[model samples]
Target: MKILYWNCCGVGNPATVREFRQLLVANVPDIVFLCETKINSNRFQRIRSICRMEGCLAVDSVGKSGGFALLWRDGIDVSVQNYSNSHINSLVRLENEDVLRFTGFYGQTASRSRQQAWDILRRVHHKVNEGWIVGGDFNAILNLSEKEGGRSKPKVLMEEFCNILEELKLTDIKPCNGWFTWTNNREGDRLVKERLDRFVASDVILDKFPFLASYVVRQSRSDHEAILIDTKGSKPNRERMGHKAWFRYDTCWAGEQELKDLISCIWEKEESNMLAKMDMTRDKLGPWQFSRFRNLKYKIKGLEKEIIRLMDGRTDD
Candidate 1:
């Protein structure tokens, strides 16, 4: 199943609402996590109602500026793993039996407390099981690769961030598309983009489910782009290529003309019997046969399309 994680910046704004709806429509993710909701439960309820229409159940922490939230599509078995008193963090257990730990951190803009937050993250990582995933707007860059203009400059904050990663034994799941996930709020030439949002997995988790595909999505209003990840298999290419075969439909027969004649004759005999015979045919058909049957269905569907095209002229009159 596909899962999406994003920081909406704030669902309170109309622009963010529009972008959120568009993303839900485009991706159709089974699970969605949001950071920096910037609204408490009562105010968030309205946004939750909109998301419910997309078949997602919204769970959130109370906060005014930076709150964490967990949302999942309906009919999937999920539950809250736990939540801290601080709106900075929350956790949820997904249907796949994997735990998702989210920390909606807005680290101290310019203070030693950033290091303390990183240390808390290290502790949280240690407390969680090996299969869990920890992610959010880290606020502090992990390494030089995360920053562009400041690449050459030494960043003490980033150094402390790196130490936390090492201590927790967590590694980044690099994005396949975008290099950076956040941008500075400034006009024109003064703006800078940096990779601040992140997805980290333990060594054991990566080894077990290697086919994880991670990438960043572009949304105009928010400073941060959304991160998307899928951890269903070990090899993405192989699994993606093979998935079509798993759902292929075909039909088997001694003679194509004979089968057509038989179906037509059975329909003339009795509509009920015709459906029964079709069911029997379906039951007898192997995977290859089912695939062939689907091809024939498409051929008939093509004829129906042409018929509709011809009928369109009469409707115009």
Candidate 2:
């Protein structure tokens, strides 16, 4: 299952929403965490429709600042565990067989005060136990190499950031590809860049799911790049609903031995009737297959919604 996370700054804007829709339609990530949405529950439906991720749960702040949300695609079976109503700290326990916990964050960027923010993260980490992923803009680099500079660190936030990582025993997943996710929009030699965005996972996550990949995509409008993670090789529970083909197309129809003869039979009846005959063939086969696919898709979607709703106790049923 592929999961993506990004601090869009504010998805409430129309242009940002349009760009997001394009990326989501192309990539089709299983789960996505959007940070700095700057939107509350009042405008979440706009985000849901624009992104097209059905059956999602969003934890929005009161105003247009420090909001974070977690969303999953329709078919995936994930149950949200122990989600409180805090704006900066949005935590969810995923009900995979391994009992995974995912916490989405938007840390404080201002100096000195970030310490309290990190403290809160550590508290949440210990409270949630091990097997979890902590991802977001920490606003503090974990190391000296994280920031672009010729001299020493500004306020030496690395030591504090590293201490947090050590305490939590979380591994930085996007070190290789993404050096700097956030950049200053200044011109000339005064340009500044920092690796503010991050995805850190516990020892259990590394040991259990080693094949999961992570990277950052370029954000067009926003200064922060979109972070994407692909959770490959993780075993999804198939026994819950049993296995069935997601989509089926007739291979037999592609290579009919007497294809010319079939067309000849239709053409002999009437020249104008040739197109109508092919249309008839499609009409007969297409609806059955398409309808079945749609029905199965809707059923899986409903099941996922039910699971999430039951776990979170927010059923409209």
Candidate 3:
């Protein structure tokens, strides 16, 4: 199953809605959690239908600043456990007969209100069994490296957030696709970037879905990038999802000067049209990328395995 979350920042905006719809169409997530919708309950009902989801529960905005929705597709059994302005807690029964507790959270912005947010989360967590997966904008960073281009956050604040997770027995699942989740959208030195949104789960759930991982997705607008939590795809599904058997530019290749020069030289050729140039570039990069660096990726994977073996002294999962 795939789960997606985004801090939309607005619900009434056409562009935002379009992006949201496009995401739903492309990825086909089983569950979706939206934050900062800035809409009321009645309006959210309409939005749910527009999203083409079967069931939903919403926390209406107080004025125009805060609102959220939890959505699930048909055939998934989801039960609400608890809810508040800062969160919507639920019990999810997956189709494969596994069960877990899910909480879609949006932390308060102010320091004082944020404490209340944490306190409530602690209280709710004690009521659930194992296999807990909580995710969203915590509005709190657990370390210094998670934020950039801004004044340093208070160290005590970071410690408090980390302490909460440690005590709750939750572990962070680092995202694989993007380094940051939000930006101030400001230019120059005024800009700020943060790893505010994430998914955390208890050890039992992580063990159950060993292939589960997250990818951070960015769109044209919004400071907060969306997160896609893929839990259904195992090793085979993953291979089928990727390795397209066709040529495409890997985003990671942009950082390599040799690859850049190769593309530039090919692109400068007397191309018939834009499509021809792109096809030629892809044809050239395919073999070159494989010959030089594809094996490097596998070597990195082997190194990762060695580290895991050193830590656990076992190759079996």
* Index of the highest-TM-score prediction: 3
Candidate 2 local Cα displacement, residue 67, angstroms: 2.0
Better of 2 and 3 by lDDT: 3
* Clash pairs for candidate 3: 1-232
The prediction achieving the highest lDDT against the true structure is 3
Give the lDDT of residue 2 in candidate 3. 82
State model 3's lDDT: 0.82
Q: After superposing candidate 1 on the true structure, give the runs of residues whose Cα lies further than 4 Å from its correct spot.
A: 53-64, 84-106, 150-154, 185-188, 233-317
Task: Rank all candidate structures by their TM-score, best first, as comma-separated numbers.
Answer: 3, 2, 1
What lDDT tens digits, residue by residue, belong to model 1 across residues 204-279?
A: 7677667876867777788888888777623545542432343434254546775566456555655466568766
The alpha-carbon RMSD values of the candidates against the true structure, listed in the order shown, are 11.4, 12.9, 10.9
Q: How high is the CA lDDT of each candidate model?
A: 0.63, 0.67, 0.82
> How many backbone clashes are present in model 1?
10
TM-score of 1: 0.65
Candidate 2 has its poorest 10 consecutive residues by lDDT at 308-317
Locate the minimum summed-lDDT window of 10 residues in model 3. 308-317
Per-residue lDDT value at 109 in model 2: 62
